[model samples]
Target: MKLSNSTVLVTGGSSGLGGATVRALVEAGAKVVIADVNIAAGEALAAELGDAARFVPTDVTDEAAARTAVDAAVTLGGRIDGLINCAGIVVASKAVGRQGPHDLASFTRCIQINLIGSFNMIRLAAAAMQAQDANDAGERGVIINTASVAAYDGQIGQAAYAASKAGVVGMTLPLAREFAKTGIRVLTIAPGLFETPMMDDLPEAAREALGQMTPFPARLGKPQEFAALACHALGNTMLNGETIRLDGAIRLPPK
Candidate 1:
């Protein structure tokens, strides 16, 4: 769908990949709502984007908050055109460790935020989109989900994070098929390591070692690169029901 004049909502839009997506959508002429738990960052970004963007404090794992965010987009912009499910948590844990048992609570939390949260936003957004009049290509709306390369090439300590991301990868095709009749497209992007705030505290050598794993570019992936692919997926009608790997062909080794 053409982003111009459309209303888009991005979950976890307070920072990192979500923030990049919010900026991209706004620059593409879409009115955007930043749905995030970090109210300060979200509001600050919305304010930076001026009138074209607004912040809707949301904990995506909460169904009510998801619904409210979507409704806020419709209420403010008159219609909901797209949704980007970028809210997720990354906890490094092994299925079994030499030190002790796996942290079940942390594992569950990863699944809840990474998988269920995405589902919450998609279902609510699809319902709202189905109610609106269809657009060209019969497109009522499009949904873009953020996954991780760990889903395919999980490192030794990424069991929980990998499972959560793999669940997202698994959901794409089925949800796309289910929403096909309603003109809603679902797609996923599995990204490699990126230089987001999360990685900022890492030692320089550690960060460099991670970047060297990428064969060609030989550097950390940029949030804007991920945002570019997301925008492309939204605009291209033929790109549904698929999980595209944006990891520069790097297969992670067992750490």
Candidate 2:
């Protein structure tokens, strides 16, 4: 699918990888909708991207909110061309911990936002895409989901995060098959540790240590690298129903 001049919706577009993807799409001439819980940041980004971009405050966990965001994008741009599911949460805790017990509520919250939230957006966006006319490549839409390296190499304290991301990995193939008939494609990206606001909360030494874990390049992955892959996935029709790991040969060890 050609990205330029297409209507693209990016969840979690207020920060991190999502923000980078949004910027890339906008620069590539795509009309983008920044869907995020951070209203100020989202609106600010939309403004920064100029006329082709709009922001819609969205709580992806809520079905209505997800649907509304997609609807708003379609209504404003006249069609839905692509969706990037970048909204996710990470809860670092052992499934059975020495410090009391694992917080079930926290675990559930991770699943709700990271796993179910992605599904909600994909379902709503796909439905909207299905109603639109297919493009020259016979494509209706493309969906890109964010998973984590934890899904494959879960550290000791990442049970909930791993589970949520694993669920995302599990859904990719099936959803792709389901949407195939409608000319919609589903893909997932499992990312390695990167320098995002989330990682900024860590001390410098800790961040350096994490970066060293990468086998080659031996540094933290860049948000732009993730955005590049996303754009590649969107344009390369053969890439679908697959979860590509963006980790730099880094198989995280149990902490």
Candidate 3:
């Protein structure tokens, strides 16, 4: 669907890839509901975008909160036309670490937030989008999920993170087929090392070294680039049920 005048709910919409998407959608003339746990930043972004955007404090993993956000999006825009699941967390504990063993709690948290949380938003939002009137082409809505290259080339100490993301990649086609009759599309974007807040925490030298792993560009990805591809996906109905990696030719080593 064309982004102009569409209503999209974006999880983790306060910052990083999500934040960039919000900006791009607003600029494209689509109304956006910024769903995020970071209320301060979310509210700020919503305010910056004025009537084109709204902020809904949300926990993607929370049934009640997620439902509320979907409802809010409908209330704000009359219907939910698109949903982007960007709320996620990462962990770096090995199966057997120096601490003796990986923390079960940590591993579970990674899955809960990244994998299960994404499914929660997808299911709920799909239900909401299902009830909407389809466009002339029988399109009800579109969903875009975020995964990572680590799901395939997981580096050292990425057991939890990799598994969670791999689950995301695994679910893409199945969910797409299940939602096919309903006219809602399911797709995932697996990004490589990008210049997000997480990367910002690293020293510049360290970050540059990581970027060099990607051929050509030889620099960290800009959030705008991610946003651009997401916009393209939203507008292209032919692209569905696949995980598109936005990595810059980077096959991470087992560092």
Best by TM-score: 3
- Per-candidate RMSD, Å: 0.9, 0.9, 0.7
Q: Across residues 1-255, which tens digit of lDDT does each residue of candidate 3 receive?
A: 989889999999999999999999999999999999999999999988999999999998899999999998899889999999888998987799777999999999999999999999999999999998998779999999999999999998999999999999999999999999999999999999898888877988999898888996888899999999999999999999999999988899988
Clashing pairs in 1: none
The C-alpha local distance difference test score for the whole of candidate 1 amounts to 0.93
TM-scores, all candidates, are 0.98, 0.98, 0.99
Provide the lDDT at 89 for model 1. 85
Q: Would you list the C-alpha lDDT of every candidate in the order shown?
A: 0.93, 0.92, 0.94
lDDT of 1 by residue, 29-96 (tens): 99999999999999999999999999999999998899999999998789999999989888987778
Q: Give the TM-score of candidate 1.
A: 0.98
Per-prediction backbone clash count: 0, 0, 0
Candidate 3, clashing residue pairs? none
State, as a TM-score between 0 and 1, how close model 2 is to the true structure: 0.98
Whole-structure CA lDDT of model 2? 0.92
Put down candidate 2 lDDT per residue, 91-159, tens digits, no spaces: 988878788889999999999999999999998899899999998888999999999999999999899
Q: Sorted on lDDT, highest at the top, how do the candidates line up?
A: 3, 1, 2
